[model samples]
Target: MKEICIVEFTSNLGLKEPQTGKEPGVNRLPDWLWKHNLHKSINPKNIIRVDPPKYSNIKDPETNILNADSLVTYSREQAYLINNLLSANKFPFVLGGDCSILLGVAMALKQKGNYGLFYLDGHTDFMDISLSETGGVGGMAASIVTGNGHEKLTNILNLSPYIKEENLWCIGNREYDDEYENEIRKSSATYISLQELRKQGIANCTKKFLSEIQNKNLDGFWLHIDVDVLNDEIMPCVDSRTPDGLTYDEFNELTSYLFQSQKLSGLEITILDPDLDKTGEYTKDFVNNLTSTFNKHFNN
Candidate 1:
């Protein structure tokens, strides 16, 4: 039996949109999922909470990433906690406040050894601060992990480039700005757009991806799933929404392959804003899907 470690990251400071006297509500996610008995179903060994440092409006002079200093501090703390869990041989199920949490996850794994990244999101998240209109760290997460962003973020824990570009694989991305797309083309990281995923079929695409990862002989890999990857009609709680994305069935199939691959070192779910989940319908549905998927794959 796999011992799951539930890690809650509560921080919305990485959001580009300034707080208008209201919170992003992403911080409420861990508790909300727990209300649905997420941990009970997974039989987690421990639940760890990594609280964010006090947020500040001040952007870093060099990085131009909003709340840069606070994000770094929070990420460091998260890395420490995750590393300890890894050392204990626990599989971390990280519930994130935003996509920026990927930085900390990568940092934790980097300290142990090399790892690949499986980024499943609506957007590529490859923009640097210079190319980013809002300069949110969330938008630059992939770039940071691949050593394409500011040193403050990419060089966390003095480990430059948390994950290798060749080892990074992105899928389920349906939305992309011109600059972001161009950057991805230039980078060594492999990107399979939503259109390509559809053309090849989810099962085939995923099998091929996993085969490549296996062939590379990577130590392990982290999976980052931003909820925005779901169709906007079904998942509208994110701050950024694209028109169309993976349906519930498609997402389940994709994750099923990933979990069964047994190559996943850790997993993180991000960008579900409770503020937009007014009637709690979206949250309930998301929880149901997540639990079903996990149970189908890892609950044995």
Candidate 2:
């Protein structure tokens, strides 16, 4: 049986403030899930938290990014914690503050050796900073990890391209930016649209990813789930809400297949805003679906 380690990243450094002095609710993701019984559901072997620096709404002048300095600092701290857990063979199930947490995990994995990434998010998150409409680093996380951003964040701990393009797979994207999607298409990372994933059948799509990773003989792969990848009618508590995405049934089937892999490293769930789920109804549904899925197949 796989020993799971529950990790909580308490940072929203990647997101833009909704208003002056107003922070994003994604930072509360771990707390919300815990209250909804995600901890009880997993009963993980370990629980860890990486707290963030004080919230700053000011964009960094040097990098032209929001909270650039703190992001670099927090990522380093997270890498240390993740490294310890990996050394002990604990599978990390990370509850993220935002997509930026990927940097820390990527740093930890890079220290070990080459690994593949299965990025499941509603948006590609692969655009350059100059082209960013919102100026949020969270939206550019995919690109940064693949060595497509400012040197400071992308080259954390003297490592660049934290995850190589050839070993990366970007899936479940429905939101589009002409420049962003075009850049991803041109990169080495495999891009699987939400429509394409559904059309190809979850099992087949997942199988292709697993086979490709194994074929490359990679160390293992990390799975990232940005909840906005789910259909908006059911999953509306997200920073950027896109209309169409995978249904709960489709998501369950996909996870069931992916989780069965022994080569899997760990998984992180990001961008589910607890503030929007006022009644906790949607949060409850998300938790229950996730709990059921984990019970049925997590590193099984």
Candidate 3:
């Protein structure tokens, strides 16, 4: 039996405004919306709600405590929990606060050395503090995992660098500029654009990605999916919305393919804002889609 654990990331400091043309500006997610409903959707039976320690200094207009540079602090506690669970071989299914929560997951899985990462997002999220055009720490998740950015996060989990560039791969990116793209090129990581997915088809892209992971002889890996990767038509409730993203069907195809690999040791879903998710439509769709895919892939 595969036991599952859910890590809730309820911080927005790392996240700034969603800059996509559809929704341009700094946007804060609603308070504890997903946290409340996740149990019913996933019904993990062993769900672990990880509320990261919040900082009291910033004037948070969003009501919820915005834990900023302090994410590394909460990540430490998360690492302990994840490490213990993984020791028993449980499948971790983490929920949003922001994409930055990846720091903790990366740390906890550090012992699975030479692990591969499949990062699915609309943005590269490779910006460093100095290069961050928006200064949103959430945009720097990839960088933090690759051993860049503030020492606090890169150094979290007591691992000098949680992941190596070669071990990382990014899929489905359509929102980034030359500067950030140049930085991404500097890393040994590989990536495919949304246009490429459309051109070649999701099945081909997914098969290629899985083949690459297999070729690497990776013992373990993590799947990080930012909700913004879905086109607004189907998933409009995300904190960030991109117009030219994957259709729900395309996303399902790719996710279903990858999940079947079972090389996926964990799954991270981030950036869903319940405040904007009226009628729980997006939540229900996301829950149903992912759960269905999980059921199909694992044949549960």
> Any residue pairs clashing in model 3, and if so which?
9-97, 14-138, 17-26, 17-27
- Candidates in order, TM-scores: namely 0.96, 0.97, 0.85
Tens digits of lDDT, candidate 3, 225-289 = 88889887777876667787888788888998888886778888888776676577776777778
| Reference-based lDDT, each prediction | 0.84, 0.88, 0.71
> What stretches of model 3 exceed 4 Å from their correct place?
17-41, 55-69
What does the lDDT come to for candidate 1? 0.84
Candidate 2 lDDT by residue in tens digits, 24-132? 9999999999999999998988798879998787878898998899999999998898888877788999998899999999999898789999998998888889888
TM-score of 2: 0.97
Give the top-scoring candidate (TM-score). Answer: 2
Q: Name the 10 consecutive residues with the lowest summed lDDT in model 1.
A: 16-25
Task: List model 1 lDDT by residue over 1-300, tens digit each.
Answer: 568989999878778654655656787788877876777776777888888986655577887878888888888988898888888878999998888898888888888888989999998888767777777888878988888877888887788788999888888888755666887878899888899899989998888878887898887888999999999999998999889999999999999988876778889999998778877888788888887888788734
- Which is better, 2 or 3, measured by TM-score? 2
Error of 1 at 113 (Å): 1.1
